[model samples]
Target: MKTSLKSAKRLFVALIFVALGSCSIAHSGDGHSLKVTASAYNSVKSQAHGNPSIGAWGDHLKPGMKVIAVSRDLIKMGLKHNTRVKIDGLPGTYLVKDKMGKRWSRKIDIYMGTDVKAARRWGKRTVIIRW
Candidate 1:
């Protein structure tokens, strides 16, 4: 009876570990993750200074594109233009279509097309991202 009890306890512990591992994996997406501050912006704001390029990649900004702008530091951290990333707490995948200024670091800017109000509403927040 004691041997059976020990085996049951071992099984229970193993199950708990498996459950925890699954949760971590689910949260980390493909297992590559980073935490950074995120904000929202639109083309108008981005081009206010007469910059002609829609993005660093030269792609035109459009609604429903699911794209993101990463800081230069993030680009050095492997978030190159056109890389796909998944933002925690936000549904859907986002593509890295733009690059932020040199002064920014560990930050992401979500593109909201021409919706200035929506961009303003999003503001800024710390978010986890996975690639």
Candidate 2:
């Protein structure tokens, strides 16, 4: 009876591990995806208040860093600070380091690091994002 109870306990532990592993795997690559209006912004006095290089989450914005500012509505939708984002038509990933004003909704602003021209060139378009 003791051996059988031990074996059953071991089996239950193994099953719990399997269940947890599958849960992580399902969320790893298959995270939440959303379609949002994407635009670009530059780190300049006219664009950012106080310190232009400082993000809303207090992350420093340097040139060539892949970071984005999400709208307030998107924040409520799981795009919280420091969230990793996979943007369609863009390489690698971007981090959500800042946030837009309350007026903005369902939008994301790509950081261009003081390059106003580049920001303007990016313009605005609808793009899919995954996290």
Candidate 3:
């Protein structure tokens, strides 16, 4: 009985691992995409997640802002590594830039649950800049 119980527990654990692994795989290569809400903006923190946003962090942003990248897989999209890229996360809209740097303004806003490390690695690398 003890051996059979242990076997069942191992099988259950294996199944859970497989399920979790599959989910992460599905999310792999897939990231939340944002848009350029304003038309012309001064500049931006290339990689950021939330609050006191990119705009508040800087000066000279406007509607119809020009953008620099499509996704975080920027290097894959031919973006030079460490180049300053920008995107707008409009509160209630979703916009994704196409490969050639054109905004396909969307009605839904995509939110990236970004972290400090991600922002630092991707956005402005200044040590004093807080998220």
Candidate 4:
């Protein structure tokens, strides 16, 4: 009976470790991971000045594109133009095709095209991004 109880305890500990490990993997991913503020934006005149569909790096943005605008500070951290990134809690990969203003730091703006409601729904939150 004592041997059975010990085995059960060991199994429980192993399961707990596995659960913890999986949680970290989901957030940290396989490559470099960073925690930053995430928001959503629309390609509109009110939101984007001058040419709304043109990115800071001269990339043309269109509707239904999976792209993000990274803060200026993130460029120094290897998140340069055209970099692919994986955002936690979001499916698929997002390309870094735009750039935020200098006032923002450690933040990313998800491009939502003309979906103003979706951008508003996204709001602002802290998220982990992998590159």
- TM, every model: 0.73, 0.76, 0.23, 0.77
lDDT scores for all predictions?
Answer: 0.84, 0.89, 0.33, 0.91
Q: Following a full C-alpha superposition, what root-mean-square deviation does model 4 have from the true structure?
A: 10.5
lDDT of candidate 1 over 1-131, digit per residue (tens): 99999999999999999987764223343657878999987878555445533788788878778999999988876889889899989899999999888899889999888888999999999999898
Give the clash count for each candidate. Answer: 0, 0, 13, 0
Candidate 2 to truth, TM = 0.76
Output the worst ten-in-a-row residue range by lDDT, candidate 4: 22-31
Off by over 4 Å in 4: 1-29
- By lDDT, rank the candidates, best first: 4, 2, 1, 3
In model 3, what lDDT does residue 5 have? 100
Which candidate number would show the highest TM-score if scored against the true structure?
4
TM-score of 4: 0.77
Please list the residue runs of candidate 1 whose C-alpha ends up more than 4 Å from where it truly belongs after superposition: 1-29, 45-47, 51-53
Model 3 CA deviation exceeding 4 Å by range: 25-131
Instruction: Give the C-alpha miss distance for residue 122 in model 3, angstroms.
Output: 27
lDDT tens per residue, model 4, 3-118:
99999999999999998776432333366788899999999999988899999999999999999999998898788999999998999999999999999998999999999999
User: Candidate 3's residue-wise lDDT over 10-120, tens digit each?
Assistant: 999999999876541112233323222222212235533332234322323233433232333433433332233323332222233322232332211222333444333
- Write down the TM-score for model 3: 0.23
| lDDT value, candidate 2, whole model | 0.89
Better of 1 and 2 by TM-score: 2
